[model samples]
Target: MSRRTLSILALSVICATPTLYAQEAGRIQAGQFDIIPSFESSMAYVGNVAYARDNDPKIYSWRAIFSPELIAATQVDGNPVQFGYRLERGVYFSSTPDDYTDHFLEASGEFELNSRHRVNALAQYEDGHEDRGTGFHWA
Candidate 1:
């Protein structure tokens, strides 16, 4: 089989595992952190890290993720758009290769819908590799 065909076959088998479907029934903790330095400058650094832990009797899963990015661009009145890319990887403490690996590219904007409610829109282009597939999210 070709490389892509073999990859698809493997992904299908891995995702079909029953353990991948079970959900944790107990407590779970999750955390995320991000640092962006001089984002409006010609050079910038972006990084994010997230972690989660779960404990349950029937199902169990934990996950940790890290994404680091860089960008270079020109300024438009101190608010400039940069061309950049990010790399994200994760490991599930109780899952398989098919249950992990989610990487994405994103663009975002925000607006004030009201005094108590604000609206934000984010566009993401996700590349799930052999695990899932490419998709988009608007939120």
Candidate 2:
């Protein structure tokens, strides 16, 4: 095959690949509720584990982070309601006081009283900790 034709074919394949794997934003319907679940994770190499300004000692370690969330929604009396929870965790190879896990809770709902009026509400809470020196210290 000619080089130009091969290049065109490669470009077309690259453009079409994303559509093949794309997920629809619509939630999964289970009974009377809609559910959506998602997860994310990352890793990094830290040359200086502790963000020390000067020279006591430098610790090297690997850091990992993970987060997962679940969302559920339902229609109540022609109104929409949603509830979700997310958890985040971080760990380091070195057992410094920096490793921690956090939890978050969220709730939201919408109501339509009439054809021209609507109401919405949202609430959220978090229980977590910050690493030393980066921000507030708990110890």
Candidate 3:
């Protein structure tokens, strides 16, 4: 399908879904921190399960994804701090070899350096992989 058509379809699906709020999605107050847990699951028809090369025959499949995440936020001496961890697992019905699992970790914070200037920093770590036959071989 054309990009434009896909974009429109995606938009339509999003609009048709009921509105959801973060507070309702997953929020828990713990002491001085808010611990939020979220889960996302989706099933889609994948056109290319193996991410086949141009010359290779196409391999189609059905893809199912399960993603879960946890976020903690609080204030340190009035400075905001946040940390999050997310895990994603994908399963392909027709192409079991294409299944994958990934992890992502993130943290950010703000510090008051005196009264006039403030410092903000963010750090992220990801353990992820691309589908077979995709991306370059750095080696």
Candidate 4:
């Protein structure tokens, strides 16, 4: 199977695990703490403007995310988890006369584990890059 397919399958299994789903009402009502982590990466290109010629430059970025949920009987934490992936790529140009522009892409996915709880996973692929990387994430 392709890497994408395999990654998705693994995420599904982990997210759907009984341990993640079997949190009884009593547990939540009493009080509990949950922590989630995530990672993301993106790439893009830069170009020239009206007066200047084409100047192509590429950029890459990676980010880490952390979310904590606090639950109490009186004040419950709204939802349990939130997760997703985003991809962005664009071109820009600046010159003495004017400027130029381009476009990028984005995709995301998430799942809610009832009215007060949620889970999610996501991945994104861009157009141009030498090291194309995808992450396996869950929250």
Best by TM-score: 3
Task: Tell me the tens digit of each residue's lDDT in model 4 across 1-139.
Answer: 9864575455445434433222444343223532222222222232221222236343322211122222222213453332223332222221212211212233333556587986665444444432211233243
TM-score of 3: 0.76
Q: Report the C-alpha lDDT of model 1 over 1-139, residue by residue, as the tens digit.
A: 9864575455445434432111233212222212242211111111211222234123344434444454333343333433445665554444444344445576654556567986566566877654322244244
Identify the candidate with maximal lDDT: 3
Candidate 1 regions with alpha-carbon error over 4 angstroms: 1-58, 76-79, 106-124, 129-139
**TM-score per model over all chains:** 0.33, 0.67, 0.76, 0.19
Query: Would you list the C-alpha lDDT of every candidate in the order shown?
Result: 0.41, 0.73, 0.80, 0.32
lDDT of 1: 0.41
**In candidate 3, what are the lDDT values of residues 1-116, reduced to their tens digit?**
98645754564464455543357546798899899887676767899777666597988976767677899999999999999999988877667788899999999999998989
Clashes (candidate 4): 0
Clashing pairs in 1: none
lDDT of 1 at 32: 26
lDDT of 3 at 96: 72
Superior by lDDT: candidate 2 or candidate 4: 2
- Which whole-number lDDT from 0 to 100 does residue 46 have in model 4? 27
